[model samples]
Target: MPSRSLTDPPRIAFAGTPEFAARALEALIGFDCDIPLVLTQPDRPAGRGMKLTPSPVKACALAHGLTVDQPDTLKTPELRAPLVEAAPDLLVVVAYGMLLPRAVLDIPRLGCINIHASLLPRWRGAAPIQRAIEAGDARTGITLMQMDIGLDTGPMLAEHVVDITDIDTTATLHDRLAEAGARLLIDTLPDLLAGRVTPRAQPDHGACYAAKIGKTEAALDFRRSASELGRRLRAFDPFPGGLMSVDGTPIKLWRAEVLAEPGAPGLISRVDDQGVVIGCGAGSLCITELQKAGGRRLPVAEFLRGHALAAGQQAQLPG
Candidate 1:
């Protein structure tokens, strides 16, 4: 392949879907590259009204007046035709939601590069951001990798670590990682286009998969240790949301902290204006914020004013 001049920006075809992906697209737009086409998922019903909503990448592409394609699947010959004809220098994919086949992968001269959320070889599937927090990892970060057929088994081009804080939720962590991923992608693009960055194979050992988060997984089990449950609550927040049942009434827990106290699992050992302290199998957690079914999330004092939960009440995972 002939090397393009350093002054020339590489032609790029971007594939992405969500806000995380959109952020990368946004970063690329600010770069000197030419994004001729953007491939995203088809519009789907979303939110309370169930209105047809475009993927964040599609919206961003449209706003920038770039051509966009929302193919249900990229495996079709017809869909792959445009990509082949475009003959892009590189294919940049981030959170595109669908796997790319070999036919599509071969279209780009420079090949495909992906911006994945977690450090390569760890938390390497659908829900990396949430999985890292749930597992209580002290740090997680973005990995720019050369795309291959395997699931995030691609060789690493660049990586940057971001620390996970005590109060960080999935939502907050996601945003921070999105920006980090964006910046990292832009920084790496120059070296990648210039052929200065070399791909490194990810280590086979100590690798783990981050399976997608399920709504059912959000059901809080107080029978577990308070520290574990507290992390789970933060990890699942602003997504499926952490759920629990207190005295047979359904509730969603938004924020909690381990209290270093012990009592019978599922028992409400104390309740005051500060919060509701619930006993776990090993320790206790002070639920600082919660919401009743069909109600907005409220502080412990506000929630207590409307629906009283006194000491001796039990909190458990919903059946």
Candidate 2:
């Protein structure tokens, strides 16, 4: 690619879905980037009414009166034509939820770049934020990468590191990473377009794919350690949630603390205003925040007011 004059703003095409990508698009608009086209997934049914709703990226584009396209796939020449016609110097992909095959990748002048949620070549696939937390990693970061045919096996343009806190859930970590990526993209874009920065290849070692989180995995298995169970609750919060069943009624666990006191695994050792203390294989887990199925999440104190839990009761995986 030819070096760009710093005075000339590059024509960029944006592709993404969900709020994470929307944040980056918003940043670009604020920066006055010359974005010619925006691509997002097609509208899908959402909420209780199952009404068709545009993705967050699409909504942002429309609100700004930018040209927006929702292509189901980019495999066909027809579907990829709009991107080619835009003549973009760069294509920024952020959580777009669609794979861009090789044909689509060659359209940009400076080439396609991705803003990934985790530090590559670690946690390289879907659900990186939650997986990092679940795996008890002390740090997770945003990687700005040069896109390749291989999944996230791309050369790094830049990266911004963010530390993970013990209390962080997927929701909290996601928000932080989104903002970091947006900042990193704008900061690096000027130099990148001017051909001032080199793309560093990712190492072949220590790569891991983050498989998508499944609702079935939310069922808390007390056979695990207290720390593991606590992390699971935090990792899955604001989604499927950590599940525990008492007398066939499924309760979702939102926040928990690992404790030293222990009993038989899956046995409820104590039930009080403090919280519900249940035994794991190695330690005890204190359920601090929880909710009944179809109910709002509540503190343990508030939850116990309307529910019955007793010491020595066995907690089972939700069926």
For every candidate structure, what is the RMSD over all alpha carbons to the true structure, in angstroms?
Answer: 2.1, 2.3
Instruction: Give the alpha carbon lDDT tens digit for every residue of 124-218 in model 2.
Output: 99899999999999999999999999899989999999999999999999999999999999999889988998999998898999988998999
Local distance difference test, candidate 2: 0.92
Return the TM-score for each candidate structure: 0.96, 0.96
State the lDDT at 112 in candidate 1: 97
Per-residue lDDT tens digits for candidate 1, residues 1-319, read 3556857777899999999999999999999988878999999999889999999999999999999988888898998877776668999999999999988888999999999999879988999999999999999999999999999998999999999998899999999999999999999998898899999999988689999999899888788999999899899988788888876888988999888999888899899889899998789989999999889999999999999998988887897
Model 2: number of clashes?
A: 0
User: How much is 64 displaced in model 1, in angstroms?
Assistant: 0.5
